[model samples]
Target: MPEPYALLIEGGTIVDGSGERGFAAAVGVRDGRIELVYGPTDQIRAERRVDATERVVTPGFIDLHSHSGLMIFADPLHEPKVRQGVTTEVIGVDGLSYAPIPDPTDLEALAHINAGLDGRPDIAYDWSSVESYLDRLDGLRPSLNLAFMVGNSALRIGAMGWDEVVASADDLANMRAMLREAMEEGAIGVSSGLDYPPGAYASTEELAALTAEAARGGGFYHTHVRYDLGDRYLDPFREAIEIGRLGEGPAHITHFYHRQTFPDGPGPMLALVDDARADGQDVTFDTYPYEWASTRLLIMIPPWAQSGGPVQTKERLADAGVRDRIRREMAERGVLFAGRRAWDDVRIGAFTVPELIPWEGRTLGDVIADRGDDPVDVLCDLLLAEDLRVNQVTPGPWTETLRDFIRHPIGMIGTDSTFVGAKPSPRTYGSFPRVLGQFVREEALLSLEEAVRSMTSAPAARIGLDDRGLVRDGFVADLVVLDPERVRSNATYDEPRSYPDGIDRVVVGGTIVVEDGAHTGARPGRVLRRGG
Candidate 1:
């Protein structure tokens, strides 16, 4: 009578992503939505069938924080993510992206600062509004769905230049208008990188005013706190919480973790979050499962010396007096990799200069030792030569600290992975699988059902996606099938590009993108917009 279902996945242990226990069931798909989820005893007919016997069937993962916004345009296949069972990624993180630019110069300036994290792809910089940029993505036909946030840095640059001055009344008004426009163009929220320039110069009142506009549109505020693990460590967290209160919006902290230098560990840091929540403020956070953290190497420069764009910053780095001031400030404040770990713990993750390819994977301390020069001079020279386009990975975190945060009720997962260069962090390819294999199966840190919920339902709820992130009737058919016993991340810091093991198949919108542990070249992904 009725037409046969388009596809069927039968005889699998269905972990429905609601923190419930797994059950044996069969799932049917038709018109890109889940048609039925029946028990194994029920008979179902389909045009095609996948015998998912002895496997764990769950919803595909959602990456809450990612830097693949521009990189995806360069390489639309995005094998690194699709192979790891990721179906959606939230981009425009750390408040730096290429949308809402006022002019071509603003886009170029932002691209230069962002080149270390997102490589300078050969694609055209054709769009200036959030809607136009999202339309460009829709035409690219990527492998995973993409959702975006309006970047605060882009907002600041659009309203003002890269000067270190605070915002005036007119400046604040212009920024608010820009934020409202982006939200109307389908952005989920606004994000900020307070430690980086342009955004670093913004005052608390300025941030509150702009975030209030996002709140008025039913969007949240995501921020990478100003500082982590130092004498002034707690101040930044307090500032972020205060912003959410002042702006009257939900706040989500990106990459919330304790550094090894913290004397009391994550207990004190997480206590701050508890206090905020107890006071009736909406706050949540995400973290990756790794001991080393990665970011642009230019962040180590003193804020005073980084006023202008990359060109001016490079000019200052060439001055001896400025270099001395930077070194003194770093020493006095215990900045960079000083307090937490030695220079040997800091490795070069990526560089823009072709000659520096050999330096990839080498420690900064090792480079200084081989060059026979002062550490400060060596660092300044490298940045100047590379035009501030460099990335670094510093080792950090304690075992107890990681366990405490991951088990917290409001905690979710985010890779914070910058997918660029030859030696990117292994988390880019291994984050979700590592949590499943090491944390869930090997160490028993969390149950398989709870882990699935964190990767699926929790992130979906955070971004307000109603039709995805769960294995339910009428939901989008984005799912993963894996062998729980054999699932594990094979990527290492040395060889960071390798994919994980035990992912049998990955489906997006009822089409198989990865089958038999290999990519099938299906590009069914679309750009997701807020309230669309």
Candidate 2:
């Protein structure tokens, strides 16, 4: 007689993550994959069973944007994401990753620059190659799967030093070779954050070259667009699509949102993608369903000010003349700059100093007022005082405009979750539930099946993962159980760390890692390499 199945889930409405309607079924799991989706009356026995009678069974969520490259090593349980039903996440986003930097000096400098966005974990900075970094995650027992991308910044720092210099032919060739090697070693694609140097220093031609290499390796280009380029509205997206066209590859825009500051409406912004897809360019986008956005405080400064890496950046922050120039340039360029309104609308956190604790969760405008100093002085002072490790939460999109992106056909979900400081973005804790509860259940923007499809199979297809994104037979068992009526996010802007409700259980690789909305300390997650 054959042995009993490893686990059996019974009496649940299976929402198969393929945008299919709900149906009553019994799921059988054996050897870490779904063995059968059987009828309710079928006789089955297993090592354990979950009575999901009143719950919805679906594929575990996949986050297309995550900043857990370092924090996951420090806290392998990864409660905030796993508790929200995220079983796999794409790291090395925004053109900022920790690996593929052969230079230790550059690695340490990058760490200082990214401390506010991704935390400064106490772990050793040992690995330099892409394969070694993924191996490091495997050794530490990551709580959820991570897919790595070759950040253009790492490539730039490797080819040329961490300066804002135009790439020569030799430099471009070196970068393409580096990107090719990274993809060969398991990197899924190349990513760029055009606002962040030295990757930001890379021009359209340079990115197109790297994208061509990635395309040869069956990869795409995932970018945080050059928001300051062209008109600062549609032009950024236009550049992304043009890169895809020039490189002859797929382009995926991350954190696609409509801000109140954009002069045009969301319609024009979305139309770029529609037109691109219409022309067979293979463009897609991901947006979190929140009105607020968060990132490092260093983002408020210009890229030229951040040139020459962290040491030079610190020197510039301390220079009086540089401060005046920054003020003037910020006024002149309007680089995510809104003057006093920007300062007033901004809330900051992630202070490690006792003296700065009072400023956490407070507006930058309020701090400037209290200190009776210019906003530039206050900004420079805070950055210098904290060693350039402050983060900001600011008003980004209006809720109505955000809903338009959510309902778009080419749009998927990427929480853009930043994990640092006392007040992280509520999207970190609430993105999936907010969509499931508020968007799908409350507002009827789309059905539950469509929402799950965006979070699961859509991202899986984008990532080229064939085995883990569905509930079909022979697929890996990464599943989520939810109470449809009770599922909602308890997290908000003022209270950001709260866990969600109605997520009953989560499974990763056929093992229950989250039960009753809490981490069960199971380390079943592995590094999911491309085509592995």
Candidate 3:
């Protein structure tokens, strides 16, 4: 019925993403699948063959938590991802996404909320429903495969207005309906941004109900938990545990970490995970390797103060009395910005505007000195101007903090970096390279085998990717080959958009998309769906 196809990736040492030691193997592909691997067969003879001697062949990297949502489609070349050997990215992260909006105003509000995925066109706004949004992805021939989580914020906007109060019975019903519809339309799961609006207004019961729907549809519940740094913030972790227990869906903790301010680091958090796992709840998580975290300037605003809508937030900034009150609350709570944290570790990352770009690689303290303004007022004004979509980075401890997660059985790696075409965070370009080069090859933090597994099979397994994240027969032919000794991420915070080095070749569905460290401009990737 269809034409026969074959290709051979010969002589590479395949890592296989199975946590097993690599061995020299020739992988064969046909009909967009691995026809044969590590065996002699007539199928190996093909019209195309790649000599990959001395190269590391592994399943293409999977980004478990990504913000590439619409950006990947907007810029199908998506060098920020492809150069890092990523073949599949799980987007719609941090409890924010573009689907299931209730109205045009709601959609506009969403676009303003996360400017990291900027330059999206209004014509791209044609899809209003979750199914239609996913279908839009189908028409775009992106460089990598994509999967999305139906955001908790999208559901809230569909159910209730962006108000600070609890939902009415009708509101709850409508929200649940949207969640159900999204899941049915092939969403892999539900992601909640507990720290952000609309979702911030949702109660634990609401979360439980939504997650239960995900479970019914055989999906996971991923969350950017409400808080991560202070005493009161630990309550959100507890809330997440409760959601896992109540929802009966696998709970995936997005951007898992612990602030240095805590006497205990990931120790207590890991213990909680153990306790939950022992109770038979499906609990897993992801973390980026860097010691710095990125988010909007609005994080300094007390959650209660931001409970009102953005209009009220802007008004509060204009009133001296209100501004002083907010400032006092931040001081009392030990909230810090621009590297002058009550705690010592916070740094600054890139900004939405070019003028702030000079501060991209510096500490928050340096940014404050450069601006010669109170960090508080600068932050407030930035939030107001950008509609709270400006980005900032906070410092973190790398050694133990990252090692603990990589060592954990259930933990995987994610960049947590938002994608905006070529104008992306360094993590988009450097995350996997840093893991392979700095962590595995240089510091010996992890064996090359372990590092590959964490980046590949572990995340693929977490998201239930079938016949993938492995170099086995009948599997998807998404693969990457690298010169192990030469691999490294060249993209630094100052030069955030640079591509990595030593990616020998990349194949998507058996088509060579990247050849010898350069993109081939191929569009062989697909829109992966749940249970498809």
Candidate 4:
């Protein structure tokens, strides 16, 4: 035999990514898989050895909910994820994705809906269904394993072309047919952006039907609820639990905290999620360790005005009567001031327009304040000029609500930020590091081991990825080695593109991608499709 093939990771204190205690172990790799975990010995010959003398080795992290779908294919060298010890990422979040469109026009609309994913090179809008989209991912390796959730908005768009009107029987049937098609193509579940259209346009009954179908396929319903701030908070959560009960699918809430209504609060929010879990409808959630959340600026518009397509939305904004009505409703809603103030702390995280570059790091209120224009009008005109596809980042304070959620036994973490090369959001670069370095260490919120589990084992089990979470014999050798004391996120609000620190080495599928905290330019990552 030509020199027995093997590599050894010697003397590392392995955390195993299973919430178990760390212990000194030598993990051996053979045939590109974990071969054994035991005390070091002199018998076995090997090809390489990673001396992890003072490091903590755990399974590669899995991002449960990410908006980095297109970016992965756009830049396979995933600086945003792989550097954070993440070896897999779940995409097609917020009930919107760029796949499964039945026509070119619908594809264009989906692009506008998820403008945060704007940097992918121009590829033909050729895939006409969800299966085709998954197929597209298969052709592109990127740098990690990936799974997906079918976007409910895409389903609606496929059936009714973004109309706000209720679906007819035929329309509902078509939507169900597409949902079935996506599931058959190996989608893990369904997601809905209820706060954003055309998902918002769907009624309780419509959502129930779609989720019920997902349940039939053994999937869950992941949602950005219809409302998550102010007076609308608890009710929407209750509605989600109710939907889960009625549809027979588990419910996974996105982001998992309140921002607008109580930017400085989150206590009540934890109570609500706990209440749902206690009731036993299979409720779960994920969170990023940041005070701010990001989304499109389109949410500033009134619901009625948002009903029509983008051109109509622009026309309504220009009409004096419509403009006044939107302002009046915004004022009456109490959400406007709350939203605007929150937006004040927020910055333009990423956008395409050159004019908006000056406003990128500035607050929304400051943008209008400095310009001497009404905030409402400026908001409307900005959306119009940007063609309703501008991306924004809203930075708020992390309250006790988030802390409590992080402490929950079932709560996992997900950096909802997308990677846009140099324009990445702070969460993309700092989420896990901030949690380990700042939130857990400086704040003394969670023990380091507990925090690692939240990022590794917790998410792996949540998504049913069995082989990669723990460092054990028979497990995939996807791991991260770090110096607990030195690990920290360096990316900041004003400069969001910085890399983190303290990551000693990162291995994906037993191959080193990050060596001595620097990328080795290796592309060993794989696209992990369900049941494949």
Candidate 5:
């Protein structure tokens, strides 16, 4: 009857995404939804059958913070994520994304600044609103489901241009209206990158006002806080909590971590979150299980120096006087890239200039030492030559400290992955599997079920996706079957592009997108809209 349903996954131990011990079951799928979850002995029939005898079946992983929005259309296969069982990703993170742009000039500048994280793919620059952009993605048929967050920088540039001026009352109102419209259009929430301009240029009051508007439209605020190192590190976290309190929505801190520069350590940092939650604030955070971070090298330049967008910043980099001033300011700030401690830790991950290809995979300290050139001069010259499309990886916090952050009750996982770089961080391909392999199996930092919950249902609940993220009846069938004994991330810092092992099958919307550890070239992903 009815073709006996579409597919059946038989004899797998179902993790169920609930942080509970798995039980043997046979799952049946029909019309893109889970039709039945019966005992192993039940007489189930289907059009197709997968023998998942020794696998742990659970909901496909969800990446809470990803930069894939930039190049998903250019490279939609996305084997790196799909192989690791990530069926859904939340893009438009760190307060930067392509959407709601009224001016073509603003979109160009954004593309230039974000090139390092999202590659400059050859595609038509046509769409200009959140709805249009999502439509564009749907037409491309990307490998995984994607959700968007309207970026504060996009709203700022749309309203105020790339100037350093604070928003006037009218400017603030326009920005709030744009935020509301974007949320209503389909965006899941509002995201702010406080360390990157013009988002960095926004004052606390301006952000609170915009966030309040998003909350009114039933969306939360996701923030890549202003700073994570030095004396003012905690200040940004405090500001995020304050914004959430004032905005009256859930606050999600992307890539939450304690840096090596933190004086006290993870204890105090986690305490800040606990204290905020105790104060009736809805605060949650996500962290990748890695000891290195990847981002644009242009971030080292102070905010004031980067005032007039990429073109103006390039001009400043070319001027001798301005270059010297920037160098002096960076030196005095004791920031990561500017200070001596970071010299050895910073490695070039990607470069747009053909001349700098040799420097990729090389440390900045080595380049400087070999050339006998000034560090600041090298950095400025590189930024100018590449037009701000360079990426770097730097050492993160201590292993023990990072472990503590992940084991925290409120902690979830986000890759913060930039897949454009040649030598991308291993986290790009390995974050979820690494948790299952290293943290769960190897170290026992978290139980297998607990880790699965963190990666699957936890992030889904955070983003308000009610239908997916659980292996249960009547849910959309986004599922993964893995061999727990062999599931491990093979990608390492030295070689980052390789896929993982033991992910046997992946299904999205009842279609087998990945089977027997290889992508099946099926595009069943949907553009997930808020309140849909």
Candidate 6:
């Protein structure tokens, strides 16, 4: 007879990740896929048997927006994500990534620029093309699957040097050609971070052209909408929708939410998305259920101050007149990037040097008060000393309005989790559990099945993963077992590193990676690509 099954997990209520009501079932796994999903396994034989009594079994979570592209190489076990049952994470987001550089030196420069956001761990920068980078990740035996996207910054730097300029006809053609090659090399789609250059330098027309190429390859446009354009409120998102229309492809808005600082209400923004979908545009969005956001400290500076490259940006920071000019500009603006609403609530973290280490987890306002220095001086001097690699946490999505998005028809989950600091956003550690514990269990905002679908199938469908995000007889064996009543996020704004309460067992490729909420030291994650 055939070999006994690799694993048999029995006695759990299966949610199935289909948005339907769950049923009690047993699951059988063989090789790396689900062999059978049915009732009792009393007649079955297996190498290992798991008593899943009193637990709820569902597909492992899929995170749409992740900043762990470089950090995963350092911490191959990837404790924070696997422990939370994230079996797959989409990276190369926010118009920042580490492949298709065409120049090793430029790759190093981009790494330094992103260190504050993506973390500069002690790993070798070995590859120069998309295929090589994917191959390396595949060989690394990472704890969770990584899906790569070709960022607009990497595309722009490859076609034209890192200069601020609207694309010419030839430049646009070159970028399109590069995108085609990247997609062929298994890239998912095009990603743009309008706040980060030289991708930020792209005009609406230029973005339309590149995304059109992606559309031809069965890809979509994932964007951090341009915040500096038009009214700086609804205008930025309007540009994103218009780009998708012009390019003729699906467009996904990432990290979407509502903040109190906006002059307009969340109603208009929600209606905008609804109207677009009703009018026959394939549109969706994702938001993390937390009140704090984290990212690189350099994003606070204006694009003009960051025009040419990292080297030029550093030189400008050293100039006394330049600092004074930026100070006046900040005064006129009266707020930091992304409409954070206030400066003092901005806490700086990820300081590497010993002197700056003491400043870690402290607010810039407190530092300015102690040093008797202007905000600009403290910012510029700190950046100069740190070599442009600092991270910060700022006030984010309002909880009152967040509830509205979480219940929207097209709303999904994307933690937008930054990985550089000891004080990363609590969502990094608690996103899935927070939704399960607070929104579903406590507040009854949405059903547990709906929340699981949002965390699993919704993102899988949006990002084009066919065999995952569901518990079926012939799907990949990425599953999680949890106590529904006890599941909750212990992570908070001040204490951001605590794991969730009730993740019992996590399986990746039919191997148990996490047992009893601890990593079992089995790394079976694959590097997910566009298609098989």
Using lDDT as the measure, the top candidate is: 2
Candidate 4: tens digits of C-alpha lDDT, residues 1-532: 4354367877778887767778877788876677655765456567888888887777788788787777666677887778877888888888787767778876766676456444344566677766777777767756667888888888888888766899988998998888887887788778888867777888777888888988887677888888843357577777777788888778888777655455335666667767767777688888877766667767667656866566666788788788888878777876656555654764654555787766655667787777787777887777777677656676543554567777677778878876543444688788888887887778888777787788887777666677778777888888888888888999887677888998888888888888898888888766565555
Candidate 2 displacement at residue 412 in angstroms: 0.9
Sorting all predicted structures by lDDT, with the top scorer first, yields: 2, 6, 5, 1, 3, 4
List candidate 2 stretches off by more than 4 Å.
334-339
TM-score of each: 0.96, 0.98, 0.91, 0.92, 0.97, 0.98
User: Candidate 2: TM-score?
Assistant: 0.98
Clashing pairs in 5: none
lDDT of 2 by residue, 226-266 (tens): 99898889999999999999999999999999987688799
Task: Give the distance in Å from residue 32's predicted Cα in candidate 5 to where it truly belongs.
Answer: 0.6
lDDT of 1 at 466: 91
Model 3: per-residue Cα lDDT over 222-241, one tens digit each: 98887742464366677888
Per-residue lDDT, model 5, residue 279, is: 86
* Candidate 5 least-lDDT 10 residues: 35-44
- Clashes (backbone N, CA, C under 3 Å), per candidate, total 0, 0, 3, 2, 0, 0
Per-model lDDT: 0.84, 0.90, 0.75, 0.75, 0.86, 0.88
Backbone clashes in candidate 3 total: 3
The C-alpha local distance difference test score for the whole of candidate 2 amounts to: 0.90
Backbone clash pairs for candidate 2 read none
lDDT score for residue 105 of model 5: 80
Model 5, C-alpha of 391: deviation from truth (Å): 0.9
In terms of lDDT, model 5 sits at: 0.86
